[model samples]
Each structure stands twice: as structure tokens, then as C-alpha cells.
Target: MAGPSVLLPLRSSPFRRYLLGQLVSVPCSWAQVVALAWVVVELAPAAMGWVVALQFLPSLLLGPWFGAIADRYDRRWLLMAAEAGLGLTALAYAAVSLTGGLTLPVVCLLSALWGVINALDTPARRALVPMLVPPAQAPGAAALSGTVMLIGMTAGSGLGALMVTQVGVTATFTLNAASFLADVALLATIRVGPSPRLARAPRQIRDGFRYLWHTPRLRTPLLALSVVATFAFTFQVSVPIFMRASFDGGASLIGTAFTVSMAGSLVGTLVAAARGLPGRHTVARANLVMATAMIVTAAAPTVLVALISLTVAGVAWSFLLMSVIALLQTAEPAMMGRVMSLFALVLLGGTALGGPIASALAAAAGVRAPFALGALAAAVAVAIAWPGAVRPADRSSRHVTTADAG
Candidate 1:
């Protein structure tokens, strides 16, 4: 018998409602990112690297603790409260900027606050998907989530630039705050079955770490993802610098480049979702493609060429991320929150470490230097992880009958 369509998860009312909320809020979040980055560049260009690093530091430090909370409590309420907290933070930023009191230090503090909220929010949000849809549709649901994020990012980058140029940074911040409120409202409408809560243990946070350490299936891919996150994900820092230094372009061009890359990601995510999740072998190849693309981006002589390379890199990135998420989600349903938090921790931790290093390299060598180093690092990661990653994933629980559909 034929299984459900790739878009089957969207048929679930709760999942659809959740996705719609993200469509509104994610773009706002991205717009805030663009505005904040530009704000940092304006205030202290040399500190841009540290600014980026500060945003992810909390996730590296507190991911497991938050994951434990998500496992023990209702994820839906956790997500709602997190969204409200994020909105309040954005409002505070807007108020500060409007009052002409926004400084580099303030920006860094707010960004760290945002990171803390995300550390609590991400695990619950990710772990909630499986509950919203059947197990078989989990991969498709994950891919769709990626697609929504990329599309939002694409729109937000472009719109953020426009807002910053015409309206002002305050407006961008305000929009982001409003978007979060909207997301909270939408989240209120979603109703899902209760999650299986774990009993209180003395060291519940350590359980996620212990699981990853013992489970080769989850551990290998996560380690690979961390490497990629550290090196390849430095594009947020690299791209704007590249635009200003190499192309002599301004905010608009940076936004355009981001949009092009996100468009590629959208395409790649849709393709992956429709075709079903790829195996570890495909993920390794995708990383190689990403490495090659970064090298190409570094060597490009013109802005047009760089944009093309970024698009290719985006495609490879989307594929790798979706594959990894699907693998983690399917591996252990009971420990989904903890496992996903570990994934977020590695990913964000890599960002925390890599952003500063890439920025310093860019400062010393050139803006293009980070891409070259990133390519090398990604290649090394592939070599280290390929053998384990290429082995077929255990998909024993992926099959779902129509009656079991959410």
C-alpha cells in the first residue's frame, strides 16, 4: 500500500496551525537578526564577531537543563512562555534604540537574553513535532519546518534591510516584537496529545549526554553536525563583511545575497521533504558539496559569482540539516527532547566558538580567508564522520498506517 504524501503532516490541523505561526514569527526573528547585526557593525565593527558569539553562548551552556525541563513539563506551554519572553526582549531593544540609548554592550546583553530564551524554546519546539504528526511523517514535518525558516529568513533579510534603510532600526525591532506576540496567539490555538513525561531524577540533564555517548547512531551524526556548524555556519558573519570589503556594497546587497542563499535553501528543503529523508551517505556527500561551494565562494572574483556560490552552499546546507534532524527525531522517540537539545547544544556551541575565530581570521588575513578555512574544516569533518555516517540508519519505526495518522 502507498504511504501518505510528503505533505501529509500539514494535513494535521495542529501541525498546520503551528507552521502558520512560524511563517509569521520566523521572518520577524530573521529581520531582527539582520537589524541587530547591522547595528553592531555600525557601533563596533571590530566587535561583530563577539556579538555573534554572545547570542549562542547561552545555548551551549544551558541547553541540557532546558531540555530536561522540556522533558518533564508540557512543551506547548514552555514554547508559549518562551515566545512571550522573546517578544518582551525585542520590545526592550526597540525601546532602547528609540530612546537613542542603544549601545554595543546593550546589544550584546539583549542578544544573550535572546539566546537564553532560545535555549529553552528550541528543544520543546523540535520535540513537539513528533507529537503533532505520526512517526512516519516526522521527517517530512522536519523538512517543512526547515523550509518555513528559510523562506522567512529570505524575506526577513530583504525586508530588514529595507526597514533599516528607510524606516529605522527601531521599526525593525518593533516588527520583530509584534511577530512574536502573533506567534504566541497562534500557539494558543494548537491542541496536541500529552507528551510522555519522564520522572524526576537526580541528574536528569546528564541523561541526554549519557544517551549520546552510548548511542553511536545519534552520536556520530551530531559530532559531524557540530563541525559543520562551527565552520560552515559562519556565513552570517562572513557574508556581510565580504559584501562591504570585497564588493563595496551596502546593506541592500547584503540582504540580496542572503535572500538568494535562502531561496536555494527553500528549494533544497522542498526537494528533500518530497523525496523523503536521505541516508547518512547522502548527508556526507552534501557536506562535501557545501565544502566545495564555500571554496568557490571564496575564490569568486565578482559579487554575482559569490551569490551563485552562496546559493549552492545554501542548498547543501539545507539538505545536511534536514537529514540530521530527521535522523535524530527518528532515533529515539522517548528521549526526543533531550536528544534534540544535544543537537542544538552542539550546533550553537560550534557557533559560539567558531564565530569569533572566523571573525579574527577575517580581521587578520582577509574577509575571504574564513571561507577557505571553513572549506578545509568541513572536508576534515567529512573524513572523520563519513564511515559512521554512511551506514544505513535504523528506520524500524518509520512506517505508519493511515489509521495512525495524526
Candidate 2:
């Protein structure tokens, strides 16, 4: 059967089912993230920095291993497990909160579990996109997914804040738990396309390291992106502190800032969706825009200025992230699951480390210092990735020499 049109993957078979599942799933996931962050802020005002840092610790620690599993297993079942885990994790958080025994330590421990589950879920869910849509429609499918996620994030963050304010954290946590349950039910019935047989798999775990190391197309972009992500994601953590200290804002205000930025991301995703075909210079252009926006963000003194800068940053964030995924898809479809798993590791793992370090620097230097440093890193990463972007060569061109291997 012919695949759905590039513009409307949502109008067809298996992809339509998956898209429906995602519509429900994305908002739930985003809601949980916002709620979890707010819960940490409430439980440990003294160590809000630490709580934020711990939230991403699992992605850093378990992402590579999960990637290895993604390469070696059926993605559908893996996603199901991940969805189920998220639901149960939500329940665990609810139990702690409902019992009126919620503590920072317990929340941290639970967040760690959520992190591991997230690490597994992210790559499989992302890499599975191509399976649902045709190769020609991959870019469109990606943009569709991005738009849904951004909208969901915007809605989820905004609603979570309101839920927390109007009702209680208990209600928010219960609702988050329900979202995961809903996602699980949606995923159970969709028909996933072909995945590589792993029964007699190559030592893909070890080869994955080798594959990444030897591939200039993959390694160069990945490493460069990691550098940029470390800085950009640091900004993600820094926003809360900046809002509280610089603007004297509270949780609701912080949520508003995130919601606004997410709006920008939504716009950017739509633009990308309209483009349809993946462009060669997408990453380079996105990075340049990102760097410019970050510089503006660092210098902005007023809340309005910061919000505008953040909106720009959000746009660049969406484009560059979608571009990065496009690059991965262009490289090797068979290896996508594995590569994406590792991609999640670096992206999120870097965020975990970046958050704590950025917070510490902000503490030692000033709130604006992290943004300054982040902008500089983004600039450099863009510069490094520039040459490769122009060449548009194969990622696997580089080879390991005996001397280097030794």
C-alpha cells in the first residue's frame, strides 16, 4: 500500500493511530515534567537546585544502556514498558504526596526512576517515527510530532501550574498518573512496522560505540550538538532561579515564562512542518539563531526582554532539535533506534550535569553568568558544526587507527 501524503500523515493508517496515542501521551508527559519540577521546588526550597539536577540524573546515567537495548529489542514492547513504568512512577509519587509524607529525598529517589524510564521511552518513541511514515514523509512526520509536543508542553505546563495553585499538588500528581495510564491504553493497540531482528544481534552494544566513534557525520554533529545542548539546557534549569531572584516571581510566573517559550516552539515547529523536506543547512541556521537569541537573553534586564529573548531561543531550539533528528534519520534507518537511544543519553545526560554546574556558577558568579557561558558554548558548537554542515558528507567516513584504538 502507498504511504500517506507528506502533508497529512495523520489522515492515514498506522500513523494515524500512533498520532492519536501521541496527542494524549505528549501532554501527559509534559504535565508530569512541569508538575515534578514544581513539586521539587515546593518540597526543598533550600535545595531547589539539587532537586532540579536530580530530576535528569537517570537520563545521564542510563541513556546509553537503554540505547543499546533499543538497538537490540522490539521498539513497540519497549515503549509499552516505558509507558507502564511512567504510570507506576506517577502512582509512587502520588502515594507519597497523598500520605502527607512527601520528602525531598523520597522525591529525588522517585525522580531517578522516572528518569530511567524516560531515557528508554525517548529514543524508541522518536526513532519509531520513520516506521510509521514513509522515508519521504519523515521530515513532515517529525515536525508534526514536534508541534504536538510543543503545544502539549505549553498546555501542560500552564495547566499544571493552575492545577497546583487551585487544587493541590495531590490533584496534579493524580492527574499526571492518569495521563500515563491513558497513554498506555493508547499504545497497546497500534501496529508498529518492521524492526531489525535482535535474536542473533551483533554485539551492537560494543559496535554502537565503534559505529559512533568512526562516523564523522554522526560523531561530529552529535558532539557539537552536545556542546550546544549542555549550554542551552543549562538555561532550562537557570530560568527558575532567574525568575525567582531577578524578577521576584513565583511558580506561576515561572510557568508562564515556560508556556510562552513553548508557544514560540509551537510556531517554529509549524514553520518546519511547512518546509516538509529537510534542508542541509537546517542545523547551522538554527544554531546561529540560537546563539543570537541566547546572547540577547543574557543581556536582557527586564522580564519582558527576557521573555522575548526566550521566545526566540525557543524557536531556535525547536528548529535545531528537529534538524538534529533529521540528520540522524538520513544516516541509517536500521541503526536509528540505537543511535537515538544514545542521542537521548547525550542530550539529557548533558542536561543533568549542566544543570548542577550552571546553578553552581550562577551561585558563585551571578545569575546572568550561566547565560553568558551558555551563549559562548553555543557559538563555538555552531562554529565547529559549520564545516560539516556545508560538506554534507557521509557520517561513517572516519576510521579507527590501531594507534588511536590502543
Best by the TM-score measure: 1
- C-alpha lDDT values of all predictions: 0.83, 0.73
Q: Which pairs clash inside model 2?
A: 217-395
Per-residue lDDT of model 1, residues 35-115, tens digit only? 887888778766877888888888899998888888888999999999999999999999999999999889989989988
Lowest summed lDDT window (length 10), candidate 1: 397-406
Q: Which candidate leads the pack in lDDT?
A: 1
TM-score list, all predictions: 0.95, 0.90
Task: Mark the regions of model 1 whose C-alpha exceeds 4 Å error after superposition.
Answer: 1-4, 397-406
**Compared to the true structure, candidate 2 yields what TM-score?**
0.90
How many clashes does the backbone of model 2 have? 1
Candidate 2 per-residue lDDT over residues 321-390, each given as its tens digit: 7666656665466567667877787788778778777778788887777888878887887787777763
**lDDT of candidate 2 vs native?**
0.73
